[model samples]
Target chain A: MATRVQAAPFDLAAELAGFGQGPKVGAVVTFTGVVRDDSGTLRHMEIEHYPGMTERAIAAIEAEAAARWNLVDSLIVHRYGKLAPGEAIMMVATAAPHRGDAFAAAEYLMDYLKSRAPFWKKEFTAEGAEWVAAKSDDESALTRW
Target chain B: MIDVLYFAWVRERIGLPKERLATSAATVAELVAELRSREDRYAAAFADLDALRVALDQELSSFDAPLAGVREVAFFPPMTGG
Candidate 1:
């Protein structure tokens, strides 16, 4: 049960080294998001987050996922500040006794993080910078759970 | 005085990140109305309420929520996190 909001990059191998180590734990699921330069003009992506509220919101979402999925352990690491294409933006990992629980919990965490978190992204391109807008499809995805 | 924060395009339009103001508005909507009346920039930023979101004391809340004891209020565009 951990949530980290930082500007520094995280090491995935180091993060997963000790994941799901408990005796009953049988599955560990991980998802990593990276900055994509889909338009081929991006210089960097600036991520801004509400300083005091981002962590709390993520923690609350993680708690909900834990309770709903009976998770053995979970972790969420989200980065702020500027990032280049191919850089890791964030990651979520879940540990559970069964693969279904682990997978579902990881997916749930990602879905909630997409819209409920207080972070915003602004992409800097060769032309200029523009703020990213929330996608209606992302909000609709929440109806599944 | 209550602290008012803005983010994303809201901050860009408002030309600042945060401000401390003395407000007597009863709810988030009233505060918004007051701000909207103050200047053209605020009016432009808050022109479309449906395109914006509000947070009270750092927690996501509704526009109609009361501001009885809230020390902070944040306004921003819809979140685009992941």
Candidate 2:
């Protein structure tokens, strides 16, 4: 298991190269979040995170996923700082002995990461910049777990 | 002294990223009360406790959590990470 929090972009191909190759690992799942300009007025996004808390919070969520699923391996990579639209924001990968476990663990990790992590996003637009508000749907999604 | 950090709109509203404060407040709620009493910016930023979240020593914590031996405190809105 690994968790990386950095300002630099990550290579998706390189990260998945040797993901889960062991005999015990039969399935692998990955999810990537990208910066979207749905409104077309977005210029860039600024992702602010608590320097010391972000990593710790992600690690804790990763641990919970591991305990809940039969995960053979797991990885979470999140980026911070200013990013343009179309850039990748974060990614999560999970490997398990079966497809069910791998898929479920990946979704669980995403639900927790969305609300529990200590990172915030601000969108810069032609008009101005505004902090993104936490969605009630995201919070409600956690109740399923 | 406790290191107080703010993020996102909270930092923007308060016009600061971090500060070191010498406070006699015993819990997160008391510390917030002390800060809210200081200036209009703080009062505005901390006006709605329900809209804000607090962390003690970089860990998510409740407002009533004790401040004894805690070196850091942070206040911000609910996270919107993914």
Interface RMSD of each: 0.6, 0.6
True-structure lDDT of candidate 2: 0.96
lDDT of 1 by residue, B1-82 (tens): 9999999999999999999999999999999999999999999999999999999999999999999999999999999888
CA error at residue B82 for candidate 2, angstroms? 0.8
Give the CAPRI class of candidate 2: high
Lowest summed lDDT window (length 10), candidate 2 chain B: B51-60
> What would the per-residue lDDT of candidate 1 be over residues A72-110, giving only the tens digit for each residue?
999999999999999999999999999999999999999
Q: Write the per-residue lDDT of candidate 2 for residues B5-59, one digit (tens) a residue.
A: 9998999999999999999999999999999999999999999999999999889
Best by DockQ: 2
